[model samples]
Target: MPPPALLYALAGIWISVIGLRSVLVEEHFFRKIVASNIFGSGVFLVLVALARRAPEGPPDPVPQGMVLTGIVVAVSATALMLALLGHLHDLEKPDNQEDPS
Candidate 1:
């Protein structure tokens, strides 16, 4: 069987590439946010995979902690981006008081 690191690294590269492509191609704000989250997840996957170098030893805690922190930060940033997108959309809406004709 292939090593865990190799598998994880491949998956991370594939996922990150896909995320990057989506981010570049998509025009909508929500799609871009989702793609960025996917890219971040791939980065975390690579970090965890690096921590598993030896088969006999336990994984280090520092990288794991950083990954967890990154997750939290990514979530908060996504939420903030979504809120800003919503506000911008609301502002762009034509005022109801204006004449439709």
Candidate 2:
């Protein structure tokens, strides 16, 4: 059987591909945002898997640290994207206020 790290890497690759495809094909901005998150998660998974490649030695700390930092950035980016989307949605709505006489 293949090593666990190999399996994780393969899964991460598959997930990244799927997410990228969705991001490219989907028209909705919300879906694209979700897909982007998936892509980021897959990248992090792959990085972690790579860091664990040397089973006999201690895992690399750099990739793990990078992944942690990336997660923080991703969350912040997602929040900003969501806020922008909300603003765009509000802007697209027709005004319902009555005109002053």
RMSD in angstroms, all models? 4.8, 5.2
lDDT of 2 by residue, 1-101 (tens): 88899899999999999999999999999999999999999999999999999867899999999999999999999999999998888788757435788
Model 2 earns a TM-score of 0.89
lDDT computed for candidate 1: 0.88
CA-lDDT, candidates in order: 0.88, 0.93
Backbone clashes, candidate 1: 0
Expressed as tens digits, the lDDT of each residue in 1-101 for candidate 1 is 98978799789888988999998999999999999999889988888887787776798788889999999999999999999988887788856446678
The residue pairs in collision within model 2 are: none
lDDT of 2 at 94: 52
Model 2 residue 41 CA deviation in Å = 0.5
